[model samples]
Target: MAAFRYFSKKLLSSTLKTDIRAPVSNNYVVCVRLLSYTPMPYDGNPDPGPIFIKKEVQTLLTTLTRVDLAKVYRKRKLGGRQLEQPVYKFMTDEQLQEALDEAKRKVDEILQIPPVVAVRKPRDKVVSRDPALQGLDSSNYIFTDISYGVPDSERIILVRDTEGTLRDADWATRDRINQMYFPVARRQVTPPKMFEDDKLDDLLKRGEYNFILDRACLQFEPNDEFYQKVCSVTYQHINENNKFEDIRSTRHFGSFAFFIAWHKMIDNLLLDLIESEHIDEANALVELYAQLHGEKFRGNSIEEYIGKFSTKKAALELALQAYKNAAKQKHALEEGIKRAHGLN
Candidate 1:
């Protein structure tokens, strides 16, 4: 069955013009990513957020992403006005070059991923208690500072419970009051139904990873529990589906790669890199693995690193063989054409 599936994949690839890796059948049970090197998904844990922030690891992740400037500056849905007129500017050679440089710098900052910290625990500190104010209301009174220029992090929020205990507002109440006062452009006070477990699962099954990620980034802070949970589950789903390319070149890819690397499950990711002909990036991933684990590699090649993989050994070997076979076939075809034209 395995041999048959591989043959069928090759035949299908020959027939398809634009899409090579997309399966011949959407319902095909087999994952097409080189026989599932590292079958199980890594739980986004041991919170690599801190380790990822290290200068060397950040550089490696950025290199793996293979940034595309066009995609980097692509306008995204901030969810306010549907239409806006494009501003036109006329400038000389130096002015236009400076403007382009400035734009790239700004986009680089925007693409800098939020740290994937562990979810923040709630704080329920009692600010004050008033016996005289007790029994004044059945529900809590929520107050928010709505002054302009007040950053959300520093904004004061207070909740007065029915017992007259004034405390820091819980996350839910805080979000509600923040929305009431200075609402984010598209986020809801109450989260959308799609974020619910069942709905989120269905979306993941449908491969709506980018949508989940984009909405999660917009709806919650990077450190929020719900935000972390959503991203965690989505990353797991992408891993299970062998769909790393789905998040590649976006801001999320760095975090995604870091998540897998942190868990020491880089086989699938490494295979994906090799299959895509990203040999240098694959080596960079190995370098990231060494840094994360504090292990020293004697050699720089992927061959040296594969000896360390405990799972998916046979499958990863086959994947490497297949990549080499493909590269040879491509080179031979190019040389044959050259020889036919008497140029080689």
Candidate 2:
């Protein structure tokens, strides 16, 4: 029985190989099965145990006929994913060489064409003339034989060249006439000569005179000196009383202080931006407000910054509100003091 089973298995394997090699015209059915085997332990009774056997009962996973195989090969030749093979196998060597030759011909044609040249026009010649004399020559040109005394009657003078023909005034002739009549204004005071070593001591003494303060000895009533002293004392007292007021309330001093405060606020805003991980915005803020500060950061415009971090924006707004509130409180205190003293 064992010899008969081995002969049957050899016959089945030969049949499968023959079917695989057969042409598509011959229809053949292929049967496949999966089996598993296990070894049973012997009980030492001088007899072998019964063999344990198991079989997979599943149907065939796929059934590809010869026609299906041909179809898959054709599809793969046209760049389909059904089969794994070199793409160039579908094309002949002569066809591939012809395509390369055609590409080379096109490239050679492009290389043979000459490059386009740019044509530039010649620049206009700039006539050099004194800038001050340009407007005067066009407006005021005294024609020969024209008298300015005849104001009532209309005098039409025929302007002509030296050849006795009517023509526009030549620039050379006009410039000559302008030079003689409208002479360039001369400097009234000549520059002082350099001081010599011996005269330098006197010059230094004269310059030191500017530092001297003349104090009046007499304090007469209704005199300019006494009135000046009184005005100075009154201004000093006013300043002392309003010392608690916001410095931004003064004219030039206020403007300068506000500018400095604005710069400090911008710098503080930079710190907020840095803390929010907005390095680009912080750098841009420093650059845009560089003029407010002494001149440190200088680069691209603020428009280049693209960040919209709301945290930094809110921080700056809060800081500005605080500054405004502080100023308002100082002003209120000053006003209250003035009202108490009957000076408001």
Candidate 3:
């Protein structure tokens, strides 16, 4: 009664006495704009999905990632279920080894590389228009069926706008409504603030690549826009700042490597590999680079082929020579120590 009385003053007021009228003054304008949304498809890309299926590309990406199981399975906050005390068991050496092997086998499934696919279009499909429902309610209504064993993707979710237009809920609407009706364990109805552009920059500056990727993977599906934007931006930052070390051993590395390769910004990454004296990985990087550029440079040595690189050539060559010098000095030192010991 009080709420209606508050709105009634303006809603029921005479047009002659007041400048404000009900249509524009009583929040009805907001409802009018609710149904005014125009759908626009937002994907601009040449479908890169086919390239990911190649065995050689997959292997190269995996090798570049250099998975560290300890990092992958590292202790981190997992919300409710993660707080439970882990089961400790007294086991024989063989049993422990078997468990270790089993865990190793599951890493691929757990850390499958994030793909660079086209952004999906919006889903604001309308179901019907009923004039009977008009003026029945002032606010929009959401209806969801939350029966047990029904998947969220398969569930029926509907929305009726204030304009009496019945429609299938958009992705954002459906996600919120479903979460409200049937909450998931770790998923939040609202995504974290870290995903916002400014907050994301702050996190990137703080070198929170692993944290961002982990939370993104947990909170959004692989094909979601949030997931794609955060991952892509993070990868670009890592390449630009030479911060690959932050994601080196984590599950996000494979995707990071692929992103770098796809973007044709492999100079810093190649330089890093050479500086770290990871010759095998450097060679593999060259192979992947060649494949991407539609060339086969497998016949030449890494040293021979790397000189032809168009960008940051001086830095890469310098790093390679520095690594070679260090390796030579170390070999010489070992030989001198052998002579000191009077051994061949």
TM-score of each: 0.73, 0.15, 0.73
Q: Compose the digit string of candidate 1's lDDT tens values, residues 237-280.
A: 67655898777778888888887777666777788778778888
Error at 241, model 3, angstroms: 2.1
What's the lDDT for all of these models? 0.76, 0.31, 0.74
**Which ranking of candidates, highest TM-score first?**
1, 3, 2
True-structure RMSD, every candidate: 7.9, 51.6, 16.5
Task: For residues 217-301, write the lDDT of model 2, one tens digit per residue.
Answer: 1111111222223222222222222221221112112212222222233333344444454545444444434433334432433
1 against 2, candidate with superior lDDT: 1
Question: After superposing candidate 3, which stretches have Cα over 4 Å from the reference?
Answer: 1-44, 77-89, 130-133, 145-151, 291-293, 301-309, 324-344
The residue-level lDDT of candidate 2 at 56 comes to 11
Q: Model 2: residues >4 Å from true position, as ranges?
A: 1-311
What lDDT tens digits, residue by residue, belong to model 3 across residues 184-230?
77788999898887788788778888889888887876656767777
